[model samples]
Target: MLLLLIGFGSDSNKGNKSTKLTVNETFVTNDKGVATISGKTSPDYGVNIDNAKQTAADSDGKFSFEYNLKGNSKKSLRLEVSKDYDDNTKKSKLIYVKPSKKFLANRESLAQESSRAAVASKSQRKAASESSESQKKAESEKAKVESEQASDITRLSEKPTDEQSAILTQLANQTFSKKYPYKGSKIHTILGNIQPWTKDGNVWFAKYEATIANAFNAKRDATLEIRITPLSRDSGNVSFEDY
Candidate 1:
């Protein structure tokens, strides 16, 4: 009877050992501070982490749980595994919980990229605004200069002096040469007509009928208008019309 009792006690101890819980040491968390705890225990055993609801181990004795560590100050978690058959509970080694190094690095990089994108967006908007203002100012100045030029052209001029007439004739000949570049082309004469002369703040205007001959010596009559800026005698506009 004594040997049988000892053997029974040994078998009871073996049964208790079979129900003990085991856990893997690898614990991981993300940048958002969610932690994963996983381990092994007797098949169908109830497993719980801290105050979380219990879950049953799988047929393979594997169990896993996720816990939000966002506001939790503790660096480790207590895991409990139990089996109803034995009415016993087992505690696992403390599972260390912390953000993974890779998670932290990725989060920091994302933040920096977001900051740089914001700055670049602001700079682009500023540059576009300044460019628009500059364009408007340039257009305004151009319109003002054009208005002044038109007013000058409408101002009356005294009768052309001999010197001015000579300048006008020379300009007409040069214009004819450029327009009809064939070597033999020439301007025969320039004759004054009504509304023939005018002057402006910066330029003189003359109109005349011109007789020209082309390279083939075919003569044609046309009206010509000439503008001369006395300050730069060679720089002005010349046009021919009324052929």
Candidate 2:
């Protein structure tokens, strides 16, 4: 602390060779918080706080503001400074008005804790994934003993398995063979392609069946899509819903 004070004193005695005006913070605490802008400059230097607001500067470039939290609060603070013979003014960094305690040690500790927490969370997620893989392997081994993978794949991939499709084709052939036996109605559409939901030796076929009696109004007409989708991979079950 003594060394720092001595160094600060030494810096004060140094000749003013810079005209840059800087504030302590880019953000302020309350709606109305003073910004202590202290810098080194010549004796006669002009510092502008706002765009054109009146400013006060001491012998050096040191300046301050006793701002108030007005109803129409300022979103940011713009500070600028200019010296004699200098054509342009140097603007300071945009000061965002926000709540800040200026606790350097606390901020550093919080950053460190956040990094540690992120590492710990990653480790926890890795452990959880490894545990899941182990459980999946165990379940696979047990399933191999009860059911054959080849048989399940063969039955699942069978084509033309829709209940409504088979029923409609069968009925159509029967009607054509009995009616003219030479001319038949064109099979244009199917309303619902009912599917069979099989599980635990029980086969439940769809109850509704619709045949496009004609091609008129076919685009607007809805077709029933049949599918056998697994409800849950673990349970080995499927449910059928018609739209």
Candidate 3:
């Protein structure tokens, strides 16, 4: 704990003034694996955990704490202390614990760097999995697009029919299709699906349906819809706003 004491004394105009400060050093290492420090002194000091919060010092201005420059603590650390906050003359010299030349000499300790390596490995694994999943989705969407094209040729256009105008105005039931260049591309990549040339003519038709709906709402950028059903097995009608 940080301790504070004020001594009361009388001052004489002709007398000399003497001040003495005895620093009781204690060590607190930061989580970065650097050197421990007594106070918030200069040089560098740290704690064992990856943080820089000040823990209270023990009595007599003495304290002991682990250092952390990083999560690992096997590195050297230095701490400087002075009588005042900015006492250049009272500055302490660098306190070396061990040089890199000494630590790198031990292969067994160097091997512990594997801990950092593990973090890198985890990130790579996640990236690979995501890439694989994306590849699979692309394949699926491509096949679906091809199948959709064959069905789209015989299907009616996305333009609102005379009958739909009354309904469109009443229920705001704007027709949207599962087609677009970017949408087709994304779906083809995400689901690994393809569309045939027959549906190609109507391909732009499906694309326009979604575009028109958004255009009606006066949106400049296009958007896609996705559905997330936890238990349902069958494909449900996905609304463009479902996402």
Candidate 4:
């Protein structure tokens, strides 16, 4: 993609001006072992390589020609341009040529190496992606277990409701027995509904009412308080007092 031009001026006093030549390309090769030697020269000069005649310069002092190379290794192709071959001759630079088989093998080897590197890079990326996904899954399972444990602790800390009615009623009756233990008075009736329990720290407390009858068959209502301490999810200890 580069262009260069040189000019020569003729002097009328001088018999004939020296012809100059300039090459456009440094080296070239094709599949058929044919090399193209092209350049520009002064008007009316015959161009040749190693004394083999080629095309003459055109109106714009431009000429191009082809020569078939006959060698299996590196060699130099020489160009010469002259009007008559004695002293006004111009020679071109030597262009080195490489063997076609060696050039093709080197090209193929480079291509295969590039392909293998690409495949290795792709496999490494895939393995990294899989490892990342596994780590994320493990973290998700750990978080879920921690959340469930937290929920269980919260439930244990709150007040109990209908699920605890049996324990509350039993504690109320036991409270009446221990406080008002009149020999003539016997247990009469216990109320079905009881007051809700309250929690402070790990202790539970409740207040309830019950009725007692004397030996004369007279009934009276009594108030009782109960306290409970839980040891686990399904077991606890209870204590009662009368008010």
Which candidate would rank higher by lDDT, 1 or 2? 1
In candidate 4, stretches whose alpha carbon ends up further than 4 angstroms from where it belongs are 1-99, 154-243
| Candidate 2 residue lDDT tens string, 38-73 | 444334566555656445566765665555432323
Candidate 1 per-residue C-alpha lDDT over 119-151 given as tens digits, one digit per residue, 9 for 90 to 100: 999999999999999999999999987655443
TM-scores of all predicted structures: 0.35, 0.28, 0.23, 0.32
lDDT of each: 0.63, 0.44, 0.35, 0.60
Query: How high a TM-score does candidate 4 get?
Result: 0.32
Q: Could you report the Cα RMSD, in angstroms, for every candidate shown?
A: 15.0, 18.2, 23.2, 17.3
Cα lDDT tens digits, model 3, 18-103, are 21222333333332234544443222322122123344333344445544343323333333333333344233323333323333
Q: Report how far residue 111 has shifted in candidate 3, in Å.
A: 9.6
Clashes of 3: 55
Ranking by lDDT: 1, 4, 2, 3
- For residues 127-200, write the lDDT of model 4, one tens digit per residue: 99999999999999999876554433223445665445445445545655665565543333345236556675
Please report the candidate that would top TM-score against the real structure.
Answer: 1
Ranking of models by TM-score: 1, 4, 2, 3
